[model samples]
Target: MERRTDRVMPPRYLASVNKVIVGLHRLGVPLPMQALTVPGRKSGVLRSTPVTPYEVDGRRYVVAGYAKSDWAKNARAAGRGELTRGRHRERVRLVALPVEERGRILREFPARVPRGVTMFLKAGTVANASPEAFAAAADRCAVFRIEPLD
Candidate 1:
């Protein structure tokens, strides 16, 4: 099977996607979700990325392909941010984990990922992502445990 490096989204489309996520979050719709907000590691500007979350044992988590992404870096620097789901918003602390722990959690990914997403993670798809690749990405990307402070 052939593996392709993950592709980056164009800046314009990325911005539009972000806007839609923020809009949906403000609407209070109950959908599996995640908001990656990171403070610029160097400049300190806050950066946020919206993602579809995989829920495990009632906790929400995200698997990223690149750890150095702006949002991941920001979360590492700031250590926390706002998590909005539909109409609910909560302040959350960021938690970065070791590869072993992350791997354990992600091992169940096939089950946790929504059925519609299986195609992407399939053997040859963009997400045909190997365990090592996933681990490497997780190592770089901050894994946040969004505990609600309400």
Candidate 2:
């Protein structure tokens, strides 16, 4: 495993990411890029950001590359958020997994998904830990199950 010494997605790139996601979504084209919209816990205004959603065993999830990131915290507090890809939009509620269960998922996370764990590694959340080490690294990140709101 290689760690990125530089920050993952610098400010300028991140600033433009949401716009790109919106454009692709409006075109009704599905891509790995998606947007998550959640209300601010304090300001109460909707905040949206670009994220890559990963699926495991028919379940969809978004892992916080930085465990304590704003989006993760806000989503937890709001309890519900919207995920949009192309023209498909799903209102979802987040069910947080306890640490014990998280470990199980985390252990298998690196191999199961494409984006999350590697991004964390680039961001230096974890060093060059072996694939087997990702399970323990799971405790340092937040994994949320995206439950569609009916």
Candidate 3:
């Protein structure tokens, strides 16, 4: 598989990560999954990404580390998406949270960090720091909460 290594780390990485997590989930280990798919704000192409999800009160969300990235911009333009995990898929609407809510979610992320995620976290790939530092870094990301359509 050709992996993307751009300094900006485009949406392709998200898809790669999803393949790994979905594989793991299929093996009976459930990891939080977030999919970011949007119609191009300008070009009209459909772009999608898989992300590590943060959950609250049965709802799922994703933190966009690079807020200005194309995925984020596309999401803002599309406003809605399809989120899938295992056999469960739902139509969802995206909502940007207030900074206070984002901070709270970030602070609570360590509890959800998967056990096998230490290597990546420790290597500074994904908020690999003390909980406080991780939260701080997460705060810099664009936080979006998803509302599933019943």
Whose TM-score is greatest here? Answer: 2
lDDT of 3 by residue, 1-150 (tens): 212222334344555775676566455454456445668989988666666676777887776655566777777777777665655667888787766677666655667745424533433435454556545554345678888767
Predictions: Cα RMSD each = 4.4, 3.6, 6.6
lDDT of 1 by residue, 89-150 (tens): 66777666666577655554555664423433442224444444444333433355555556
RMSD over all Cα atoms, model 2: 3.6
Predictions in order: lDDT = 0.57, 0.71, 0.61
For residue 124, model 1's alpha carbon misses the true position, in angstroms, by: 8.6
User: In model 3, what lDDT does residue 25 have?
Assistant: 49
TM-score of each: 0.65, 0.77, 0.65
- Rank candidates, lDDT, best first: 2, 3, 1
lDDT of 2 at 136: 62
Clashes of each: 8, 0, 1
Q: Which of 2 and 3 is ahead in TM-score? A: 2
> What tens-digit string does per-residue lDDT give for candidate 2 at 1-150?
534433333334555766777677767888777878899999999887777666767887777765677887898899889988877888999877766666666665666564555556666655754565665666666778889897
Off by over 4 Å in 3: 1-34, 115-128
